[model samples]
Target chain A: MDLQHIRQDFPLLRDNKIVYFDSACQSLRSQSVIDKIVEYYTDYPACGGRSMHKLAARVTEEVDAARATIAKFLNAKKKEEIIFTRNTTEGINLIANSLGFKSGDIVVTSDKEHNSNLIPWQVLAEKLGIKHLIVKSLPDNTFDLAAFETLLKKNKVKLVSIVQTSNLDGVTNPIEQIINVAHQHQALVSIDAAQSAPHEKIDVQKLDADFVVFSGHKMLGPSGTGILYGKQKLLDNLQPFLVGGDTVASSTYTEHEFLPVPEKFEAGLQDYAGIIGLAEAVRYLQKVGLEKIAQQEEELNEYLTTELLKLPKVKILGPEDAKQRGGIVSFYVEKVDVHQIALMLSEQGIMVRSGQHCVHSWFNAHQLKGSVRVSFYFYNTKEEVDRFVRELKKIMNVLL
Target chain B: MFCFIALIVFAILGIFSASHRALAKEAFQCVFRRVTLRACNTGFKEKMQAKILGKLINRSSRVAKFVSHRFELLAWIFFILSIVSTVWVAKGVYDFYVYGNCNGLNSTGFCAFDPKGNNSAVSTISTRPCSLKPPTESDLTLKNVNVSLFPTKNTQAKNKVVLIGCYLCDYTRKAYPLIKKFVTENNVQYTFAHYPTKSASSYLTAYVDCAYQQNKDKFWEWNDKMFASSKEDLFKPEYVQSLLGKEGYDVGKIKACVNSQATKTLVNKQIDQLVGTGVYGTPTLFINGKAFVGPKPYRVYQFGLKPFLFF
Candidate 1:
């Protein structure tokens, strides 16, 4: 509970006097994470595994170390199971393209998925003339597992892709259960853990998911860093998404041979600094303990949710309980513009996100106004919540 | 060859100066119909031929006969080449004017002639200062603050000031007094947001959250201490407790709240809320959401705010 000590690690929290509540969108960079990246840029800024020079060797070593760390963090069976990607979007796109979906094959996803997960499947289905199916969420904003199972049973579903945690609602899906059901029907599952990986501990082997995609920036790592974890066997069988110089083993004018699964998929020079920074971020997270971080976020989320609900005009979106909600509390005011409230809070030096929370389909379907979202992290405090509520009341008085 | 070129130049000059009777009619016709000027030599070509043939006849009659027989063919070829060369040069000049280069490749080396010396008049360029000027009420373009749920209609006694600065930043801390003076003197409106520019700014911003929860009224006092203290002593629990302890505040409660997850989450939310607000560094000041570059002189505010208030 010594956040002052913990807060010392994050420079942004120390320097900026404003209350920050938008960790779900992107977490602030920590000092250790920054140092790791700076080390790469300042000391050994060279291509990894491409040269025999000392700098290249150093870069290769750090890259290998990062790969091993990520493999262990995600609990991948083998180090080769993890692949570095630019971000979650690229990772999902890789899976969507490489998995070899055919015409008439169905890809199932939940209604609460982010656009990164949704758009890739939609494009895949369109390009290959395949079927993209959705498993609708219940009124409480939790996944409809039964409907998902029914869809899997009814169709020859090639893949079941879903978000491990909904970014908009901060609702963690029952991914383990969903994966189990998909496996029962012999359908492979790809979990978009962009929201979950930073906040929760992920074990690919434990979940028995075929693929997992998550971003580094969302988890206090560099912007372009991300990981796409797939089983070694599946990765070996899947086609490479991108192909170029480092990807090939040998080539003639007439034909070319690919090197291997991960390299063939990498295609270009990777973001070495970002990858190294992500490994450092994982180290930082491990030291802090994801469990403790999750607990802190949950506590803060509960406090904010309770305070927001007390307002007669405010309506909470997603699950009402904090345990289910994780770290985000989104709500819209009655007879007032949510964005205006966000502006007023901003004017008071309190920051909260406003709009559809990038869940346009869900918002549109539910006939709800874009809500003011107060997302929490380990660095948030109760006083900020109070100030935000006080400011909200003041703005409400003027507007209402 | 020089005489032949001079004769052609003279004939073209005759077209420009029609009053010049010294220019023979044959030479005038030769300029117009150069191809059909068999009898219109104006004695220039004949004199040149006679001079050349006279020397050639003395040296060898066969060579002189060959030269006189092919003279008309050689003359037509020379005339056609001169016209084509003139057009090519003109095209190069036109390209140079349009594209700032004569050759299609834009390399000055390829230009038929390097026109570099011709366009050497120094252009006097004037520019406004890179910094923003304080606006008068009539001159100021009012933009909606664009925050959701903020009422746009009412303009009353409320003075809205948005201070964008990092709590832990040395620059922001130093600028705080000037800002405080401005805020107190004007009494228009006041609010502040975190824009941490320092290495460990996030922690400083989060600490404010903890202090604010313990006693909302004393938040500003705790903030002043944060600015006043050295960066080294800023994060120490004992130092924070000692600073707030003088104000009859519960040190233990404030410490516990500061250490809580709530403070961390609030800090992160603030960072996200102001993500695209153009707040890269500390000490960014805004009035009614219109931004003004911070750490500016006190006079900037004196002038910047004076117009809006007077109007």
Candidate 2:
């Protein structure tokens, strides 16, 4: 894959000439994604499932097509299993509220999980009297499979909600093994692929994950669009969290019967433009091929991590092995504030996320200052990584 | 020759006192026409004579005459007063030029005819109101910066996410959802503090606090509506009342509290407290008392709050 050729598709990169390394936070949109969104606004500016007109029918067809495409991309059993949400947070909240965890029922999560996966369960535990169990990570920030197993054995585990990749350090959890362990204990598992989905192809069927949640914006789609894929049997069993206009089948003055699966969960008007844009984003990813995207990110991460390690007083978060990590490399300098470093890098037209990378629990548990996170995507290059390191060295001198 | 010497002195003083240029012109005119020599005095001695005799003559004419005769003593007193006034004016100008404010207090009005020209905290350019606060006090030992006591979504536990914003501000509205997402995503604790831009914003902020007083759940509902409203509809009491009524809130109680002196003081005190901390704009964030101004992208907040999270 030619890096230069792929870089041309992202207008923000070409126009701004910025070295964007904050893909872990949100990905830069390809022109295709932008065009798809524009097409929705200009050609078929109508709500789906609400009207019988040509424009509305076209919108409904396109939205259904996007859903089928997303279902196929994730390898879900059926399109009915794919639920569209505002983002991963809402997706997680829907499941957390619907799962019906009674008092004393334990929901286990990793220290490595993003707050999206962590907080909803925390709120559930507090509000409903359920047990919110946190499985601590190993010293190197790898998932403690042993600790996770111990928690499962000791308690009646209801669900094991975990992140596929640590947004803070890009440490990919051994989720397949985790899924097997949780299944052995008759516990369901949900995966937060917010950090992993963009760089890697997620086959929910192969992994046998009960639920998979990720944001579309993190994967080159527009903001306010995300996917929540649940197994058909599980989606059928769990109660619908949101209820409104489109979610119900039929309503009386006093009561209403809900629609089945995905429609039941997707309440009110959806971000149809964003949903359509997501289909284009997924096509763009598929055209590039997930394996190639993964390979490019690994190569970039290895180079960036190695260069970052060469610098004095730099401490990399998570495992030492770059291959074990995803597309991110986060680190901190001794006696220097990471935000100051980020601002300094920003002045050089190089962008990186500084601080805890939204995994504040990990930093708070470990008692360290937030690290500067440089997350690479397919469009990033060795040259940009070199520029980032050079800028970091300059920033270090200015900061110290 | 004496008049020529006086003219030279007046012109020289005029050149030095450029700020007092009008006064200098008037002095030049007085000296040019050789009008009443009393004009040359700038009313130092004669004004003193008038003040002293006017009071003395009220009681006794003999005493007033005797007092009026002591022009030498009165001249010395006038000379001393003139020197004191000159030093006072010079000090004020020096303070205004060096510190961007006269009287050495940011709260006080600047001196008249100041070259810097009403250097208020808000407008560094020449403008009337003294608006800018001092740099946000990094020292977090204050009464007004209240930590959020309620458990918000994502931040169920006590992890620090202090959001200082104006309810009426557009950026604050845009920022609220992003901030809420960030806070929930990290499972960090959250705090909402007001740094209102509009006078009406203070009441809106107080309404949320009052909502909290009535019901914490209602506070979140009120808070959401405040940020969600269009700029035109944001401060309208009827709109707010309608929203509250939809939520089944006692709008009467809220209305009464809004108008109450106690709640007004509570809101004003909180505003004063934040102002004291040096917050000048909406959407300023303080993660564990680490202050940063303006609304930033998600990544900036993600990484910016890291060090503070541990602390």
Q: Give the candidate number with the greatest TM-score.
A: 2
lDDT of 2 by residue, A302-383 (tens): 9988887788899988887899888988889998667766765676678889877767888888898689898999999898
* CA error at residue A286 for candidate 2, angstroms: 0.4
What lDDT tens digits, residue by residue, belong to model 1 across residues B65-89? 6766676776666767767877877
Pairing residues by index, what is the TM-score of model 2? 0.58
| lDDT (10s digit) by residue, model 2, range B85-116 | 77897887655543334554232355574434
Best by lDDT: 2
lDDT score of residue A2 within candidate 1: 76
How big an interface RMSD has model 2? Answer: 33.7
Chain A agreement with the truth for model 1, given as TM-score: 0.97
After superposing candidate 1 on the true structure, give the runs of residues whose Cα lies further than 4 Å from its correct spot. Answer: B1-311
Query: CA lDDT of each candidate?
Result: 0.73, 0.76
Query: What is the TM-score of chain A, computed separately for every candidate?
Result: 0.97, 0.98
